[model samples]
Target: MEPAPGLALVVVSPRVAPGLMSRSAWQVVEAASVRLCADADEPLAVAVTDADLPIQVYAAGSPALLARHLVERAADDNVVWLGSADGDEGLSDAIADEVSRLNDPPPVEVVVGSWDVPGARLLDVVAVMDRLRSPGGCPWDAEQTHESLLPYLEEEAGEYAEAVRSGDRAHMAEELGDVLLQVAFHARVAEDHPGQPFDIDDVAGGLVDKLVRRHPHVFADVEVSTPEEVAANWQKIKEEEKARRPGAH
Candidate 1:
């Protein structure tokens, strides 16, 4: 008899909530007679139990071993492969290449169980900036002031603009990081202001408040149908904000 008709490869992100996984993936996992993970101690196993499925741990090795095992186990019963954040793409690739060369290949399906939230790693950037400015931190970072960082800020901004103009995605990503570094650096330096100390949260909070206020179409019931209307509305909101400022004339 031929092997099972289909196999499931469920990929999950470490940071993502297990409940957020797709219903189809859950169905496959729930029906799985054999569930396997790369490691038993991995949090993915914990998430599997949380999802109300029994997952068994396996020794980590080449994808060929896993593929062969899945093919064999799936021959007798439904098998589910629960993968990690990066989703063992290497093993998956190797499995695909190996199975393609064979005369008989069991159908394999891949699904992402969960996805990482966008911009989640940015918190690391903020934390690193704060640590660099903290007590007993980097001496150079500790002593730098707004005046000292101004030149670098200007330079980074120029480079970022040039990258944007050139439309080179690689250069844009690099230059954008440089610009963000300047922002984080400035926010960190402001923490030492004798009269007024402010951190990245303060900076981000103000920006958030400003953005929410300006994008009334998004956050409020204000209806805007066109990009031009949105831009005009943002300008109007900015003027109102400026008028309400303490020193505004």
Candidate 2:
């Protein structure tokens, strides 16, 4: 007799763009006899249907009910469950409980469809800063100007320096985060500037451009024997960059 069909639970990161999924995720989801999700409007669900695959939108009930339904369905048909961005709270444990009650439960696997890349959390920081400055968010955050935030930025920098001096790794990380928050806050404030406006991406992009341009030893063929040589090369690059700027003498 053929082995019973199994269930594939596909989890995707909200940080990642929709429709971009791992090969394994696509394969399992494509091979499944039935695709299920709680919401038809979810990015993953929409992506799946956009690819011409059929997906059923079930009314989201309690975790236990959903788990029981999934296991029962998977007993006869291969099933793919597109998990919610918030992780379908407690659903996995409920599924485990339901599976344990059966004499012969279908095999279940969790497939990671998309994962956060390095620096993905920085996106969250930007999002939070936007929220804090928006109309309905914190009044203090919404009212803060770049000039008003300068003192806090300086204070945070000092705290970070002290953290480094004390050799407290945890404190250093926390202080560094505070410094980053100031950067985000200032960027958000800049968005409201009447004369000139720029977001965090602009700030980050400029920094990235400068880093790539200055680091010849790392990014280009320039060779440096020692730290002093690297510094001298950096200074030379800085002067060259200054000269090339529109207003440079």
Candidate 3:
């Protein structure tokens, strides 16, 4: 006899934008007779109530224990497991091991309810900066101009350098975020430029172009044997690009 099938439908990055769940994920959540969640105050719980699904909190236990609890439900009906922002990979692993031990293990399907675009979280920084610089935002942030933010940009860069020297990963992350904040802030402020206005996407687009143009070895058919050769190629490409300018002599 074939073992019954079970599901571990995990919600990914739901907290990035509270309740950013996919339709298919919601359908599974709605259809499942038994829904299990890690916490009630989490974004998943909010989504569950929104979906009108009966969700129960999971007790603290080993991954194998959790897997057994969920697969047991599979014997009678479908199971939906709502995961946290970071996911529960350990539980997934436990489920796989537990299934192997069972005489007639149920088939397990792991479903990702949502997907985050690569570097999508950085876009959130841009959005928040836009809000801060817009009307009815923080007075301090709204009053800031490109010139006013220059000092902060320098300060953030220095802090990031310090983090690198100290070799503290957490500090490095925080300092890097501060530097990114300055970039996003400047991009937001640039929108007010009378001659030519641009946003964060424009900034990133230019970077992408420069990266692609300089890294011919990676993006094109050009080959380089060493990092030094790659650097030389980058300099040559940059000079060629600069020479193309109308004012270049």
Candidate 4:
């Protein structure tokens, strides 16, 4: 599918609850890229004053400990939440930090805000940015043309391929993220043109949905004994789909 142009911000927030973090003690806030840690002696109490920033707590070994700390140190105006350790909740849907379990009473001055930091949907980002760039957005990103971005996309793809060949997991991860950025950048560009469903969500969502529809064994009841059988099934489905197209051989 063709790509469109858009922008996104990666933010980290404080982990509200904890279970196990002797391993990796960092977590990202869904709305903004603010990281929170309980292991550090110096609390980021002053830093959490930003009203726009989202909070995400990592409940590694002790949920109570993390929750109490956030409750005590968090600004009264700042929003906080005690969420599950898993990445199940987005920055916008998190619960507030003020409410506490009766078992452990911690000094609390911060009051909870009902408002949660709403996460920006992928499609929403595209639609909003497109509107902004329409004789309205900043001159730089708005002035960019598709051809100008081709080099960047090519560079990112090459880096991804090289990273894969190198067998360095970290490099591969970084490269893959850059490739994603390229996809988003291209989508944003296509969106500027007419007669196109140019958006990053459409590109990503279509690919995900297509993969699930194509892989019946993984998404549906269909089963296969061998890789050859799987390939045959996929081919049959593709041929049937092609037959419905305007031209097929």
lDDT of 2: 0.91
Minimal lDDT window, size 10, model 4 = 2-11
Q: Could you arrange the candidates by TM-score from highest to lowest?
A: 2, 1, 3, 4
> TM-scores, in order shown?
0.68, 0.92, 0.61, 0.47
Error of 3 at 111 (Å): 7.0
Off by over 4 Å in 2: 1-4, 243-249
lDDT for each residue of candidate 4 in 96-194, tens digit (9 for 90 to 100): 333333344332322221222454334445555566556766677677777887898899999999999999999998898778666666777777677
Each candidate: RMSD to true structure? Answer: 5.2, 2.0, 7.8, 15.4
**Model 1: per-residue Cα lDDT over 1-249, one tens digit each:** 333446788887666665567787777777777888887656667777886778888766777777777776765676788886556767788778767876877778887777668986777788788888888789898889999999999999999999999999999999999999999999888877899999888999999998898998999999989999999999998898889999999
lDDT of 2 by residue, 124-165 (tens): 999888999998999999888888999999999999999999
Task: Report clash pairs, candidate 1.
Answer: none
Ranking by lDDT: 2, 1, 3, 4
- Winning candidate number (TM-score): 2
**Clash total of candidate 1:** 0
Error of 2 at 35 (Å): 1.1
Top candidate (lDDT): 2
